[model samples]
Target chain A: MTSSGGLRGYFVRSENARGFSLLAPTLILLVLMMVIPIIMLVARSFWTQSGMIETADFSLVNYQMFFEKKIYLYVLGKSLLISGSVTFATLILAYPAAYFVAFRVKKNKLIWLILITVPFWTSYLLRVFAWKLMLGYNGVVNSGLIGIGIIDEPLGFLLHNVNAVVLTLAHAWAAFAILPIYVSLEKIDKSLLEAAADLGEGPIRSFLRVTLPLSMPGVIAASLLVFIPTVGDYVTPKLVGGSSGIMIGNLVTNMFGRGNNWPMGSAIAVMMMISITLVVCIYLWLISQVKKRSN
Target chain B: MTTVAIDIRGVSKVYNPGSNQAVQALDTVSLTINDNEFFTLLGPSGCGKTTLLRLIAGFEQVTGGEIMLFDEEIENLEPSQRPVNTVFQHYALFPHMTVAQNVAFGLERLKKPQAEIDATVERVLSLVKMKELGDRRPNQLSGGQQQRVALARALAPSPKVLLLDEPLSALDLKLRQNMREELKQLQRETGITFVFVTHDQEEALAMSDRIAVMSNGEVQQIGAPTDIYEHPVNRFVADFIGDTNFLDGEITSVNDDLVTCRVGSESLFEAANSGNHSVGDQVTLFLRPEKITLSAAGDASRQGRVANIVYLGNQAAYTVDMGDGIELTAQARPREDGNLPFATNDTISVDYSARALRVLAK
Candidate 1:
């Protein structure tokens, strides 16, 4: 049994090696692309930068500076608020569309789903600029409103604000939000809805009590997909957000690019990631506890 | 002295009306279910029994005609506004709610007090023998347990009528039999009219006080189980309910209460006159297996050879072939010594009374 061929058999016959080898390609790519970059960022966050060069010595001065200057904290809080609002708005808009496709459309639902993702086939930046064109003072919306005689002058409040960023980002992430919600809603048994109606609940009450609760997993997935990425988005704000609408992402970009405070930028990025993770975990825990209590 | 709980008058439902794919799911069906009566709609699949039940439940709108509950027209009312609850097929228990919540849902929607809701939920759960599992989810229960919860949920609201849409088809045979008895008892105890729908004739005969046999979206007969079993109106009903042997004949004489018919080419048999035939009319005679008796004596009514024998547990079925190629099936209980009256290939004679034969128009 101790032959030379046994060496080749070791990897082929071993269950653990087979499993590990199957996953090795993805694991290596993930380590190089994601894990290694994250580790380096975390390491660089603790280093201090002198002039234009980074020092090897570890210090907490960047965090101290962040605390001393209240703008970073305000900007972070504002970014979180903006992302939260965008998540809520996007879900509210996507839910009815997804529900219509999932329950009301009896034939060719795949076509509707494809139509929803048609915007994604184009470049995301192009769509964001398209939103800019629509929300501009002399854009289609203002012209249509003026042509309809509803307004005599173009509205200046339509662009370069937090509202513009929320609107644009919600439109940009519509496809992401709708698909998961659609999948979850599709998984619910239609008989359950009929049972609800037979139990004396009106359509509205049935929706609140049965339909909404059953489709929550999809809602949670959609929220996470939109919320996490939107929090760190810099382009949307840079194009639509003016001086008063500057967010934490803009400050981080300035620190890394023109400000040349790489360590401070890394520290802010790390803090933002940790805070987002903490909020998501707390939300998940809260939902679980709520479900337990109801049960 | 009971009033009608539900009266369906000329109800019809047509799906995709006026389109190329249109289908008539139901056609002008009429029924009147008395209060506290256990009524069943028995038919094969796609025969519109479930469609009629849904019409009563207001899940589907009838294309024509009115449905009245307790003499009040409810055909146009919404399901939530109607005074009826359904124990759906497959026991559609809400997956997210506990048993107590599922039971309390209807009562809560009716705006009952919290104390009353809790009390009714507990009481109904106990009625279905699911009191101990009130805190468990639907996914955590067995099929029978889930069915009980569904019944308890429907019964908790104390609706005027309960619609059961093949609620026991998912259970094993033993559980289904047990639930059948329990359901009859529950219906009697609660005094609520139950409209059960199933395709099983045996289940219908065992459970219903009165049954309506349907075929191709039309009601063939509606009467007591014995009445329907003893006297099916047409060939479809006669063939659908139980096994029967048919013999083609021509009526030679039609008297007051008796009709003499020439069977096949030579034999003669008299059937009780149903007043629907005349002299020289072509007719089909329906005879049940148990009614035809096999005797070995040569002096019997008609002579035949035993072609085959089927050994049933308590009875034996013999297929007798009379001369002139006439075949008849007769069933007989085994004697005390476990012996059949006649064996295969033995010579025997078959005879049946005049009342055992049913003559239907061809």
Candidate 2:
């Protein structure tokens, strides 16, 4: 193997093959975990299903049923709205925290970073459960409000709603949103801020013109990181989402479980994946356009 | 004399006061910068020149005393509220903006009309001779181009006072020389008071109308370049500005116009009185290297052996060691025949006029 001879020599001689070899492990894992499963799902969407098991036959009945049935589209739309709201809320909350950590809190920055991520040290399920305990009807918040005489009874509107799901998801991924934003904000050259001030801009205007624009990449990254996962998140909606709060993830789960409609479930999964990919592409394109226009 | 543009009265800066890490960066330094004049604060690093500039620009607050811009006190104003802009050393142009946009930034802040902003941007860009490349981003331009854009951006606002903090220090040697002349011309055309801070003595002397030489935390001297160069007030001012030879001596006699100082035991040098030193006081006489004349055969005032000769293109500097073991450098222009008048290890007599010497109190 040390000498350049035979197979080793051929490997070293071909530049394309060398690059392929370097990427082979990741390529194989992606094919196994992602590509193959997606292909199977797409293929299954075109097959016929009797109850749960999909028959190996070519049919478009699942897609046909999707257009005929209105519930799936409603759930998908609701899921999108919830995901977007969570992304927006998470970003709005994260930017200030990230900005403070990046610019204001100078000493012990590492400690602040660790503290920002301290909530993630616990299991995701545990964090959701903690939120469940706080926001439940008879939870700490209601009891505290009742004890203070601010509320006559435990508020029924606190949990098991779209707002509850959004609040929980936003809190859950707060660290994910903050970390990337903080990294990008921290990378900005400090002299740029001073230059803006010297050019007759006040602190607020300088931040809007320089700081926010420079940190857009981080905001985009954080937005995608939180939005993509929460769109298909099953656990949060399952625990907190009531009947009206059920999203597309619950629909897919039901189709795979008691509904026993594998083809329909596969069709919905494929459609959801396609829609997400389209949204992300459009989002990235818009960010690039904004950056170009500013430049 | 021009009217005072910016009056810095006994301003000082102390960082992190009441803490163990506290530092006094500037002492009670007072200076009056004239309108339409190119004023420079020249000093080495840690000499508080930059701190003073920052205080004037309102980037830093003075720990004590007042700063007046014309007739109003400006020490309490914010940086943006003050009518001064700085050209940073690194030319901190906005990396995400085009040259035109960067130049228009200040005008836009002032809410100037769109057409007026465009005209002003064009005028300043062309003033700096960067009219064609206004569409390029800062990163797309070269170092010199970026520097010009920085200058254009600062000048676009037409500020009352321009503060340049070692602006040309980042450029190459050839570019630095060209920019110095351009900067002086710009200052003249704009007729704005310019407060430039630099550590390069040559740059300060070449461009500034008046220079304030600083050391430690105090202003050592302030005068025109020629005054500061020919007649420095003290040893620090003389040593910091240019090449000089200091000969230790004591004032032997103080006449009406001249003070005679005795060097070692045999040599006595006479110079005009510095007005501060009297008879019998210890003093050091400063003489420029080029002012001393070297001869082979003459009964000159002083004599030394040529220990080493540095051959510059037009002139050669002879390191002459006197008989008393004191060393002095004398520069001699090459002869028209293209032959060196003296060589290394040759015994030469050195003579300098009394007017060329400056006696400073030790």
Candidate 3:
């Protein structure tokens, strides 16, 4: 029975072929939902507007508009700065909390993680609106401050500003930052920490040398999860942000909704995607370089 | 220059306070390790051997009792503050570090000079025979190489005591055997007191200067390998250390030096230097398998039939069924002539001297 190697090999190949055929439908659906739209967006970026159909007059006019317009440049720069700040702040704040959750809190871990994720279950619009109310001129924050007698008057700079956008975005995306970092921290073997301790590292030294370096993957993941989405978010900026808080996402929305320029919107969307992709690639490359050097 | 390296007294640990289901991991364990001796805690799983090691390492606190290292009270010290290092079961080499960096990590933490740290790392790496592989990451090395790197890292700081928690359990059988000798040599060369924990009896017997056989959160016996093998305190220790043939019987006659026990119908057995026992007392006689010899012709002493024959490479082991239905094993070296002296279903005489059996009081 074991002598039929040729037949067995053919059977295995056919079985793998059957498996691939079974996966064809999901692959087709993914291509339709994700790949097709990306290709269409890139194609639309090179075209001129012609009512409902795109004209064949391909030019660098959209690219020139993006670089030449000072408003677009300012918004793009602000968006990058805000997203970068949020990423750094989230990483710094989330790391210790994640380390505690992973190594210190040995009991009720799932319960605590669920509690961390509870804010995300509520409607995003409602949460943003609540932030708006809290940051308003006569909102609860200003009222509480005045009641406490710390600030004599309501600070009008609290709402409709870049600070509000950053604060609200940080609050909104905290769970995103915490979960990945917590997972990465959790995946570190306890024996590794014990080994570090055995090697004469105090708790602080162990954290800096072992825990911090090992959790860089999670930090990068959390950074991308927050920064990539926040760079293109318009809701928080529109609600809590005044004229000074306009971001690249707001411009992209305006070009698509009120500006009635789908080609320009697609061009801006492509640019944003390219910039974020480039930044993420550079970050990953730098991290890999550091890892290589350490090893 | 032999000084007391570690002095542990009345150490016990209980997890989950105020609960009836609490687990007593360690129970008032006390032992003093000499400065340069290799002491091993040998026991089965859940026997509190690892717990005792961890308590001495200051990774776990004792509920009651004290531990002294280098004649100083260190029971309350954190693991980092203790003058000890541990080689974990998995080696736990920092995946982010090269072999040289991992070895130098402890020295760097001690704030040693760069020249000294480099020299010590190189010396220790060379001691472990891993100097050439310093640039390789832990994942790039084999299991034995990684284990050596871990040992180098642990010893680079010149800790007072090196605690090993089943460091060889993860290696393959051949590598484990090879590393065992390397570990012993390393300990001897470094002159650091080593407290090793292992469940493998062979490993414990081979490496330890003194083996503490533990069971049920308590030390059953602590002695040299030969003493532990020849004289076990209880049935658990006797059975755990090696294979032993036990015969349950009643002591018919007892004296200061010897005891005559009635093993079966019409069979009288003499045990030499048997422990304190009274007449008509129920007792058990323990005999090692290799001590008994099998002869084809019935001897006047003990008689049985060959029930089974197992031909090992260097020796032949036979299970003889006595007339009373008790099966006993007798081992003999295979002769070079290949002449078979014993066969299945053949009547055989199982003979052993009075000194071969150890009489244990019930």
**C-alpha RMSD between model 3 and the true structure:** 3.7
Residue-by-residue lDDT tens digits, candidate 3, B138-195 = 9999889998999999998999899999999999999999989988999899999999
The candidate that wins on DockQ is: 1
What DockQ does predicted model 3 obtain? Answer: 0.73
Q: After superposing candidate 1, which stretches have Cα over 4 Å from the reference? A: A1-13, B253-257, B294-299, B302-318, B332-351
Backbone clashes in model 3, listed as residue pairs: none
lDDT of 1 by residue, B210-265 (tens): 99999999998999999889989888888889889888899999999999999867
lDDT of 2 at A81: 89
C-alpha DockQ of every model: 0.74, 0.69, 0.73
**Collision pairs in model 1:** none
- TM-score of every prediction relative to native: 0.94, 0.94, 0.94
Chain A TM-score relative to the true structure, per candidate: 0.96, 0.94, 0.89
Question: Number of clashes in model 2?
Answer: 0
For residue A66, model 2's alpha carbon misses the true position, in angstroms, by 2.8
lDDT of each: 0.91, 0.90, 0.88
